[model samples]
Target: MTIRTTHVGSLPRSQEVVDFIFARERGEDYDADGFDAAMARAVAETVRKQVEAGVDIVSDGETSKISYATYVKDRYTGFGGDSPRNAPADLKLFPSFLKRIADSGGTPQYARPMCIGEVRSKGQGELEKDISNLKTAMAEHGRQRGFMNAASPGVISLFLQNDYYRTREAYLAALADAMKAEYETIVASGLDLQLDCPDLALSRHMLFSELSDAEFVKIAASHVEALNHALSGIPAEKVRIHICWGNYEGPHVCDIPMAQMFDTLMSAKARYVLFETSNPRHGHEWTVFRDRKADIPDDKILVPGVVDTTTNFVEHPELIAQRLSRFAGIVGSDRVIAGSDCGFGTFAGFGAVDPDIAYAKLKAMAEGAAMLS
Candidate 1:
């Protein structure tokens, strides 16, 4: 069987698009019509780039979002006031390295709004625009398979702190209910809905840093339950979930291993599980699948990343093939898809990989998948 290629959403945005995103994020006045035009052009070009590079499934590059999780503030009404920046645990351990990142302008600056009032959808106007843009672009490129990313309720709670809800559970439930519409709308538009849930792994060493691994897994399971509730009637095959230890170049020593949380991650209703496998910190985790192959549900498919995202070096095609083969050896090749460790451009202006090099890596990933096929 032929292997397929895809990526975690959020490719690098053009400068014109970045300017408009920042303006809107700052509440600064800008020509609404102009912003729309820029986004349309950007999405079209991004889709073209992916298709030309041999990605079977593509995305809008998350051009419409500020950052994956923080974009929720625009769609929902309860977020207000800034949430303090919480550095990852591993980064915190090395203050000098963290300072170097700050000095080098590597840290992305954007609003992290707190949930200060009741969570409610403002409407689907922005989401509809995103769908329309992606559909039009895909048609232009003659590409059929695509996925749209939405921040998971737990990730929303993780980044956008809750000030109004009495407990974390209440906050997550409200968010899940509020976000259910967006989740359904994406699938209804015929695009696979990707629930970005870095909260499943990233949060352990950041949000719940003080808790033991077992305790954090319990919290993660609750998060999965909330995600499952939001995913209620959505077809499992139409949905995928992305789990990652934060997407940055860091020590990542504090990250919880996949073995500790694999069962809880599989508990989500999504049929496709996308996660990091290329980065040095987590690349050895193929062993986790080898040991726990029995735990994966029969219907689940694995989208192990064959290329790293937070580095400039474009992975060689043969190396990528080797990476894919490891996962294919554990799960059948029929159940595997090629993907990236995370987004090339997670934020509008922030990414470690250069734009041209990112696409080069994607091209290599495609060649690698072809080798497996």
Candidate 2:
């Protein structure tokens, strides 16, 4: 398998459609078919562009969802009443310098569950239908080698703020069972599945601050267990788990060190570990691999970010090649896949760089891979 990787988080959207969905929440005038068609076109176009640029693996540009993780809350069966809310002031992960620069703009929120709703998980049938749509769109546009991204249960449970459950364990179990259905869908689709697990690291900043480090590790382990349970029959080769710090143009000083969470992460039943390794804050942290590699099983692959997503400047191909070479040297080229530090558009309404610039970055990455080869 090739080691190149790429991303197109959220494509440029017409202002009218954005307003209709966000401002009106799919009001009466909104046409679902038209919306789906537009999204499919955008996804196909983006994947086509990446494939042409030599991205070995591709995504549908995450075009259908408003926000990556928040989209699941709408599809999920549980949660009643309380809407998503902003992260508390103290828990805000961005540093003071960034806050001042961002003008203290309100960050995205998670939907709080006031009441436990029935497990409205996506079964095999729903999975087939959606996967069919994406695959068909790809085929129609002559695109190939694409994957789907699913939000991790930890992310869903944490961001949604399930305060209704009597115990944290019970809340996690409920979310685990519900999310398993979605996992099943991804497995059955026959396409590659990437679990979006930014929560594994970012949760330390957004969800739990009161707990000791030891306690936090325990909580993180449960998330891994749930994923392993859902992935029981699936071959690890078909699945990959992606972990990152918050994807924004902010100071990530509060981000958890990868070493602190490597144990729980390696325990996940996935063949590939997609992790943040680019960006100024996390770049040198690759040394964590020297100490933590013992915990990582040999069968697993490492897809380290070779380019930083929060910046608009294009990385020199030589720099991208060097990053890939370093990871390959540490873990072997066969086990390494070059990736981005985070998604280009983590938040729907906000973006640090233009979508076209994001593509140029991927193109640079592809060129670098060729140079290294």
- Best prediction by lDDT: 1
lDDT of 2 by residue, 208-293 (tens): 76777777788888888877776777788988888877777666766777878888888888988888777888898788886666
How large an RMSD does model 1 have? 0.7
Residues 77-178, model 1: lDDT tens digits: 999999988899999999999999999998899999899999999999999999999999999999999999999999999999999999999999999999
Judged by lDDT against the true structure, how good is candidate 1? Answer: 0.94
Candidate 2 off by > 4 Å? 8-20, 23-28, 83-106, 109-115, 122-130, 140-144
Model 2 lDDT on a 0 to 1 scale: 0.70
In model 2, the clashing pairs are: 84-110
Q: Cα deviation of 265 in candidate 2 (Å)?
A: 1.1
